[model samples]
Target: MSKKIISVIVALIFILNSIPVFAWTPAESLTSSSVVLMDTVRGQVLFEKNAYKHLSPSVMCKLMTALVTIEKTDLNAKVTISKNAASFNGLNLVVGNQYTVEDLLYAVMLSQGNDAAVALAEYVGDGDIKKFVRYMNTEAKELSLKDTYFVNPTGLYEKAQYTSANDIALLIKAAISNNTFNVIFGARGFGWLNGNNSSILTNQNTLFWSYKGVDGGKLGTNTNPQSFSAVTTASQNDKRLIAVVFNTSKESAFSETAKLFDYGFSKFYTGVLVPKNISQRSIEVDNVKLDLSSKIDVYYTYPVGDSFIKNISFIPNEKLKLPVNTETIAGVLKYTLNDNTVIEVNLYSDKTVSAPEDYRTKIKEIVTENRDLVTIVGILGIIEIILIIKNLIKFMLRAKKTRTQQ
Candidate 1:
């Protein structure tokens, strides 16, 4: 081929390669009554379909129960199953048999144990499961979840107890935020803690089958009222995401949650906006150059082939002062998308300097601190000056008398 023709072809290929192979688009084929895909790392809703519609998301509410349990009690402590708990339909809990709180947590999340959740509630509530339900409602209120209400820890179908997809996502994020709770949620299978009832139990969450980086998930199904739901957490390349689906079929719950994860993961790629401890820009304070940089890495998620603009501003415009230590705030760094601030970090100075004005101020402060000593020194200096003046007068008179005698 001619060199000119080859060059033209190469240029065309390069231009085409720079474009996205597949453009970003909203997720489709989702039939769940309520759905939400949240970027848990940033806590932003990446995708949603009727996310706020209130419905019975069912057993996924065990996530909230597990959250309360981890916060209020010890995980190593053993909880004896009660008849009320043992009467529940799942996990086959034996009345008066003791199980570690940690094991029961696994049951709550993995084994789909209504009995295990109730047992945990009774122990944590001082033998009153209703009190634990109250605790869950209180926590939901504190978390600013307006659509969540709890009537039981087991997540059994109740007309009075209901939650939205958004609330369930929030619950999953909160539940996994704790290390212990996260471990329990991530468990694919766990053996019984009791020696007599020892048997390996597998997690009912189906996301583990086809999803990559699925850390943990929960599936809730109530056939009596025909409600099915799923909450899933997964991570990819240091970014974590949560997906919640409600009012879907039992099989579709898993598939729909997986689809949400796929959409959420494929929609964005992690990019380091600015490196840590490297100067993005600089400002001068009292003639000392202040290189502005974040103490930690500044990262943001964006669609593939997308670009961003950074607009950083120093707040109060006066924090930039002399005698700046390493800990001094240089300014606030803001990363924006479409004019909305996605994240704001406090920029710090890599240089320290003391201005002449600062030194004078410092001296004044020292003098104020030791005013008595300063006063004594001032009086002694004035007395010494007066003595020198008197000696000079005597010497001048002696010199004049000698000249007259001569």
Candidate 2:
């Protein structure tokens, strides 16, 4: 209707569109060929680029080796190094020397030792390296690493021995669940000994020295194909994240990992989405009301927007007996997050649910809980009973008189 008004509206629209809109994404700044940033607790991926693409894991396979060795053998068991294990160029072990599984695992973790990986593999496999590799593959499959395969325990530059960024992230995520693995991975170095053959193994992953909240890390470098990868895990303010990067410089591998971590830390927040012992409902148990509550806290990570929604479904016990205390699980609250993640919090009774009492006992307790009302009702009931008896006696006397007259 007016050309000037339409012109003003057009200018406003253009100005609105011109304003720069920014979203937190890792691709522009991160240079690794493949990368994945994931929330460790939720297993939720924050960012990924070519994460499924097959890339050389290099010495990073030691992460899997350490995990397998721990599962199959005792850490205190002594492992004798063989010629095959000593053949690896890095961290050469004495051919006949014996080292504890724990000390050698330190070599694998901190030194990124091919020799140490092979030794552990041979020891766990009963002198069969391929047998140990099979175990690695089995673990990879079990972890749902669709793009990973292990041909060598040492992570030598074999064309067939390749793993994706996502696989490494997930692999280490599972590996860290074991306390032994977590402890060993976090160590910077150790004075390991094979009898008098003492040597110091220093961790190659720099995150321990550089980053705060850094707990675990694994580093890998390959000269045969010239590739570098790092797996870093850190926790801060109740949030733990895992970052995996491949095909970058040895320096950038750690730096890029830190970048991803900082991004996650700044952009996301994690806390209890559903609090522990929160009352969900109240139900009658044998004429007594009991509050049903969640057993534990359900934590989740999200950005600025509260994007995920929770749906709780209560599954009460089929035969929940009365007189149950707070220890007894009344049921379970199955909280479904976006049709993918399900957190089952066991529901418990807030207080004891007692069995129904006998009438006398019930009255006594009622009187105890409320004396004034109980007294008033008790006196009235006794009076009513006496009045009925008195009326019955008068009627009986009248009947007796009539019979005597007859």
Candidate 3:
């Protein structure tokens, strides 16, 4: 090759290599049987594995029971124990225990009592488990848990009761968003006040102590699935991540959950993947190169040490027209979190660009606005000019007549 050609090619290669590159770290294997990690605010799914397969979620179902009961009854409202509820296979709240909704909620959640969960359901539905079951399904649908189906609140091994890790994560998101629900689930311990003041059942979520900045959560187990599910909210340096893991070993779920939380907080960060100052490449509009004017920004609070890749994809909307309206979406910003879950942002015109106007059109607009005043002024000026011309002609004739008389 000629020396000139070789030099030009070398320069181009150097320029291309100088451009910056960024990416989020890929995930490592976690100990849980199934996991679903996500950013709650941005709706960004950071990690997952076998999240949709239906499996048993043991006492973890109490979250739903507690939530549904709270939805139908006030905390202080009294609910009498039903014969059917008291017979469920677990720690039975004695048949004669007259308790308020609040007391049962504490006992059911802290002790993982089957009877307490059933009693609340029966009290809410007037001794009808079938109607209460319907309520559970309806609530699940409302929360968009299409993969979850419920036949009972206690999450006992029933023929039809089942949920997946994904559905459980969705349920946790819904529960934590509610102010009252978040407060109740995270509560460490509350008094039963049923005569024995010394009787206390603490929460089962151990991460609250072993894990730092750990928020409210729950744990569940059963023979068929050996399922364990937990919702944890942890923050580092003011950044936060909401993590969910389901169907893990009873001994390892806490450690697995903690490791997942650690990975999230330690590897990634929350900021605009596409920095605010950077401009998108230009696009052709009506044979003219119009500067692409749309911008994208992503924000979520996360742990400092999590791995993340800043992927920005450009998409075109064929339906969009040239000189785009500021309000119209011309494209989308597809953000792929390192975990492979994706989200999209609509790209719109950065500024208003309307159809152009001509000089004549602008003048016409001005004339129309001042039409009455302009017309009257113009008529008066014409009359004044005509009168001056007539007076000048008369003076000229008078001067000629005076010269002839002299």
Candidate 1 Cα misplacement greater than 4 A, ranges: 1-26, 193-195, 223-225, 284-289, 308-320, 338-341, 355-406
Better of 1 and 2 by lDDT: 2
The superposed Cα distance between candidate 2 and the true structure at residue 63, in angstroms, equals 0.8
lDDT of all predictions, in order shown? 0.79, 0.83, 0.71
RMSD in Å for all candidates: 7.4, 10.4, 12.6
TM-score of each: 0.77, 0.73, 0.66
As for TM-score, the candidate ahead, 1 or 2, is 1
Question: For model 2, how does the per-residue alpha-carbon lDDT over 76-174 read when each residue is reduced to its tens digit?
Answer: 999888998898876768889888999889988887688998899988988888899999999988999888889998877788778888888888788
Tens-digit per-residue lDDT, 1-406, candidate 1: 9999999999999999998876434454677777888877556677788989878746656888888999999989989889999999778888898888888888888866888888999999999888988899999998878898888898777878878888878777766778988888888888875546568878888788778999887778765567677778889878898888775487888877777777767777767777898986688887767787888877766656676454554452475677788788778766666325377778888877876656788899889999999999999999999999999999999999999999
lDDT score of residue 259 within candidate 3: 76
Worst 10 residues of 1 by lDDT: 308-317
Candidate 1 residue pairs in clash (backbone atoms < 3 Å):
none
**What ranges in model 2 sit over 4 Å off?**
1-24, 141-146, 159-161, 192-199, 222-225, 282-290, 305-307, 310-331, 352-406
Error of 2 at 36 (Å): 1.7
Worst 10 residues of 2 by lDDT: 301-310
